[model samples]
Target: MSRHAWIDASAGVAGDMLLGALLDAGARLSVVQEAVDAVAGGAVRISEREVRRGGLRAWKADVSALDDQPPARTWREIRTLVTGTAHAVFERLAEAEARVHGVDVAEVHFHEVGALDAIADVVGCCAALEDLGITSVSAGPVAVGSGSVRTRHGVLPVPAPAVTELAKGWQVLAGGDGELATPTGMALLRTWAGVCEPLPPLTLDLVGVGAGGRDPAGRANVVRVLIGTRSSPIASSLAEPAMLLEANIDDLDPRLWPGVLAGLLDLGASDAWLVPILMKKGRPAHTLSVLCPPTLADPLTDRIFRDTSTLGVRRSPRDKTALDRAFVPVKVGTGQITVKIGHRDGVLVQVMPEFEDVAALARSQGRPERVVLQEAVTAARETGLVVGAPMVSVWAGRAER
Candidate 1:
């Protein structure tokens, strides 16, 4: 799928409003329904129609709240709603977040951003993209206005703590008087926007204007989403993608390399290593290399500069083609284990337990980790483990280096 997507934070975005616009714009109802189905436990009523704004026609989504609603949910509860979405990648991303926060993914409730309506907004946006027949999307730079917004959590600061949290590594322009973006809006965009810099190249197909309810003077409170076609093939889609970030080091503590590698892995680096080369005759130096996802390039690279003696990092993009990949959930001896499965044309080609999860399971079970690992392997061989699943990949932290 040469699909691309983008988000526009013109006059700020709220869960309800964006959902409304997406519904109006023509997002798929089924995808939206499936996403939010678990949040409400049954289903939330919704309707959509083409709406006009600024003399331009667009689709808008209307969420029908139930006659009865659940009690005001805590942050912990909100987290579960998305987890319950049942989509592998979504769930894994939620869980990966738990890993980042040092909490069970299920335990980290979503606060105001995770409410049913917010969930509906996300689902609606997902669906609308499907309905729009938009294979690729490009958005203008977001304008995140300055100032604070109130929430159940209390009178938090402007941009909101959640919005600030989600803005990490994202290029957000701040200029609006107040409330140019909402947490839910940022969350969906961060998860879906494959890249956030200068909009990707594309041939304009149509322009979607999601009107913000407010009418800012001289500026329309409208989020403009451009649906378009790529002028060229999405090469990144085919390559066995890898990122190479290099740095020159001459004056760092040698003792930090191991921790750096561990730190990189913790921070979502695919691979990190050092090359010993003589910078000058008799002057031995090292070239540090970090291979990671495009998304992870910035944070982990930042870690190298901070933890090591590197002054800067240089990056080169790379792609490698490989067979399709999958994941399996296997019933090990006493606990379940997740295995990374690779495939070619629906055939199981390779399987391996995620060492980290296996190690955790073994530690909990009071058995040699290898034993738990072996049992998982055996289970996979016997009748095959659970089918493939997506995972959340994050570069959360770096070890002491």
Candidate 2:
């Protein structure tokens, strides 16, 4: 199973809050400190404290600098100070700031975010995430507080200009009476999270609560981090929620079916097929089904309507589980061919050669396609690649044929 981390920003988010949550979730303090110190030239120090908000306990992170007045930095200067994922986060922040202030990205100077403490918060949080071995990161809808906030530029509207620009195209809501999602927080979310949705199906492994700066009257002013493995019926593996769309058409021409199906597949459908069916009044029909990731559902649905003679389409969300697959090379005559291997629960379940590779070898060597396929399969088996029960004999029979 793949390890994933989800940030619950239901209340709000900030750079320190994220760093604190990562520490609360078991990230090594030394690792975060080292990363921040290296990037800031050992000019900043990190401190942690146990804090409570709305009767709930959490961790609070504080970053302090030895220099009284740290010089403001340009986007290019900051890029040279940090590297890897932290560098990417700053790049996003700089772009958003440039857009908000109507200045060139290279010429934009980070006023608040350029401070040593803010730098530590951003870089340290990224280093903490890497220390935890998280492969994927997601976030819930963000809460951008309603009232105005004081900034280096003076009292600005809540969710400040930079914050608003950073949150473009993301799920956001208004709440609290002050600035909730800061620009640093938005930059982290925008750069780190590939998906913005509610908590998905997962077996919870760890939970971390990070306290914000203020203690609201009734709400828990904190951000949460959930670390876990994806859950599914077949096995504990990496899975994603998808959509399955179907349309029944009895009036379309049979010759046009091939193009319609191909079009759906070409338009990003994970899988597409047509099933023969008998519609009302004993009319012969076909049910066109398309499986695709949720993000592509709308465009692919439009393509279906334009490409086929279907009046309506039905769609439903689906959870898909797939075995871990990889390709291994096997010698076929003088050329090498690739064999696709599928694994379930660390045991191989299926092995087959790339059809195009086998067919190409057959034509080049003047051998029957079946002979080339059989040779590839034999080579795979001779390498002692073992799989689980169901598909073993099935693939073996195909080789013998």
Candidate 3:
């Protein structure tokens, strides 16, 4: 079964909290320390201890710098210091800060987040995830507490500018009385989480609790992480919470439909389609629907309004399930074509030549598209790539046709 990690940020999250959680969940301390030291060039040190927040047992990670006053770093300089996933996390953090402050990414100063401790927290967390063999990560809605917080820039509102900037497209809630989610926490979540939703079906393997610095009144100051494998039959398949946006349009010109669909797809809609419908008074109309990640709902809704005649759009949360799929390249004449394979329960169930690839090969070889498609299928089967007898029969019938 494929491994997945889910971050429970109901109480909020911070860099140190994340690192501690992973450590509490059984990540090797030595592995995390080695990666942090290598990335920080011996500038930082990490330590951990068991603690209780609101009577909940957890781990608290402490990271410190060798120097009394660490030098501030630019995005480029920080990128050079970290490698692999850690580097990617910092890159995203820098981009978000640059956008919020309206400066070039290279000119964005790290300030508090640029500190050695923060660097160790980020790098160490990434290392822990790698060591735990987490293939994917998801998080619940983030909590951004109320009140003001002090920073090098002076007293800023809680959530901070960097946190707000990073959480633009995400679901965030206000809670507690102080800063809950920090810039480092938001950056790490934005970089690692593929989806922000409630927990999915999983077989519990382990749970880790990471305590925040303070235990606020009447609440647990901790972040919980649930690491496990999916329990469903299609564990390796793609299933995510999506938003379905639909609008009924009767007056728009038919010519604009294609453009609207294309625009939606370009704007990151997973799927867009039109459905014929009978409106009130028996009038003929079309229901325009776009299925996209929940984060894209608002922007895409605005696009629908701008591009269609509908005055309102209906939005609903949907669960989208898809097969585990991959592309395998096959030779067609002198050109290489990719065959799309779909698997269910680790067994290949469907295989088809990508139409675009088949058509391109047809054009280059001066042959009919059908001929090129058949040749690709034959090659796949002959190479022992065919997964099941049923698929072979289906392909054999297509070859005859």
Q: Which pairs, if any, clash in model 2?
A: 348-387
Which residue pairs clash within candidate 3?
A: none
Task: Name the top TM-score candidate.
Answer: 2
After superposition on all CA atoms, what RMSD does each candidate show versus the true structure? Answer: 10.4, 12.5, 12.9
Higher-ranked by lDDT: 1 or 3 = 3
Q: Write the per-residue lDDT of candidate 3 for residues 160-254, one digit (tens) a residue.
A: 88889888878999977799999888878877775588987789898989989897778999999999877877565667899999999999999
Candidate 1's error at 126, in angstroms?
A: 3.8
* Model 2, span 1-401: residue lDDT tens: 44678899989899999999999999999999999888888999998999999999999998898889988889989988887667767877888888888999987799789989999999999888878876567799999998898877788998789888888778988877799999898888777765587887778898989988899898999999999876653543558798999999999889998888888888889999989999999999999999999999999999989988889999999998777665767677698778887755334668788999999888988889998898998887765455553222222222110
CA lDDT of every candidate:
0.60, 0.82, 0.82
Please identify model 3 stretches exceeding 4 Å from their true place. Answer: 235-321, 324-401
Q: Kindly state the number of residue pairs that clash in model 3.
A: 0
Error of 3 at 287 (Å): 23
Compared with the true structure, model 2 gives a TM-score of 0.65
Worst 10 residues of 3 by lDDT: 392-401
